[model samples]
Target: MMMSRCDAEEDPSQTKKRKLCPSSGLPEEMVLSCLARVSRSEQASLSLVSKRHRSLLTTPELYKFRTLLGCTENLIHLCLHIPPDPNPRWFTLSLKPLDRRLVPVRSYFYQPLDAASMVAHGCGIYVMGGRIGGRASSSVMFLDCRFHTWSTLPSMGVPRYSAASGVVDGKIYILGGWADIVV
Candidate 1:
């Protein structure tokens, strides 16, 4: 028996037709724009859709959203060297978001602080005083966002942790409960 052209194109075992492209469900441009507006975490998931979708999501335009979220081009800088004994060396890292081409910034050995916190405002990242090896500190470091340089600033009144910082007017306000209490 001879198979007809239509019969040859159709699979006898498969009743469903294969989709040419999932993109037909949504306009490519629209989908790209929507993905750009979402968070990096969300965009990461969208990139898994297919090779085409992943390509669209990796564009420079879409990747710029990471910088726009928490940092601007002018508000990013590199830091080298921390403080307080131990490993005192300078390191470079950007607080800004990054694209696939760009690498995440590294942290410098600022102080022998067990852990530190950072706040970005007015094109600068204000690192409030932290505990050095579990000891309270009064040292503060500021990075000039535009220049990518580091400098020391006035210390916080007290060493703190789990602290929050923000910009009010032109000043950085550090507010939070201290890790240690003095009786």
Candidate 2:
């Protein structure tokens, strides 16, 4: 049974409160609802609290609540071309209590700086249409903010990476990053 304050046998004269959290014996749904109010950066740290916390932090349900509650923050992710490195480096603007700064998001994926056409939609950054090895890249990469995971969507039949791209009406539009088309 999920524990609640009412479930506890309280001494009438005693005034003490018990800590209730996902790891502290609260119902999984309740814990997720509470945690959803917190920011993603803090949520990253909260995952270290325990095994239960770590698991709960990665659930899509938490983010769904966050979206419904309008608690989601705008995440600014930038990819800059730093010479000497073949691929660009990715960094995200981290918002913390009273202190805001850009924090590097360590990505394991290799995205070509020149050929990749990227766009930010909802909680994911879609990196698509790039030149992998001097050839058109058809791989569409998705980065989920909830868990900072890199996943692939269905591959496109043609390379569509370009400087001009956007997400309109939930659809991704790419123009000009074709291997054969030099712009």
Candidate 3:
């Protein structure tokens, strides 16, 4: 007996059978809508199925999930690059309830020459020691939101880069980092 086109088909070398989509049939838009409800990772996977599927999966409605869920506000720092450079430009963003827009607090424009270790607490930002053009910098810059000014403070223990910092009980703590030797 001959099998119909819609019937399961098997390869001559294999016993397993495979099913095929009905001819002239189209995937329901509801299916894509359902897929859009999945997580971002899953949506990205669905996009790989086909060009049309990719387009549907990456639509603004689907990609806006992060922003709608308030996840984007948790990001503290953003490293942006202007291109043509191997390193990314870094900027610290303020996510305080009073401040809705991301603020460019600090950057690495003078990196290798001047590097800062910054920590934000309350409404203020603290930046520690850095070097300028291979010379150790003893300057400490602080940003006062209330005053909206950058002021110099007491210098740090050492001039460094790639350092970590945190605030505890209104005091800033500086952690491990490379210190430049001044001649």
In candidate 3, which residue pairs clash? none
**Residue 40 lDDT, candidate 2, scale 0-100:** 64
Off by over 4 Å in 2: 1-26, 50-52, 67-70, 80-89, 94-97, 104-114, 160-163, 167-170, 178-183
Model 1 — which ten-residue stretch has the worst lDDT? Answer: 99-108
Q: Which parts of model 3 are misplaced by more than 4 Å?
A: 1-113
* lDDT, candidate 3, 7-118, per-residue tens: 7675755432332223313333334345545543234345557666654543454334444544333325443554687444444445556544444433313331245677
Q: lDDT values of the candidates?
A: 0.54, 0.71, 0.51
Q: Write one digit per residue (lDDT tens) for candidate 2, span 85-119.
A: 77787767765555466655646575544668888
Ranking by TM-score: 2, 1, 3
> Which tens-of-lDDT digit does each residue in 37-80 have in candidate 1?
66443444566678777666556544454355442332223333
Tell me each candidate's TM-score.
0.42, 0.63, 0.40
State candidate 3's TM-score: 0.40
Candidate 1: residue 17 Cα off by (Å): 76
State residue 25's C-alpha deviation in candidate 1, in Å. Answer: 59
Give the candidate order by descending lDDT.
2, 1, 3
How large is the C-alpha RMSD of every model relative to the true structure?
16.6, 6.7, 18.1
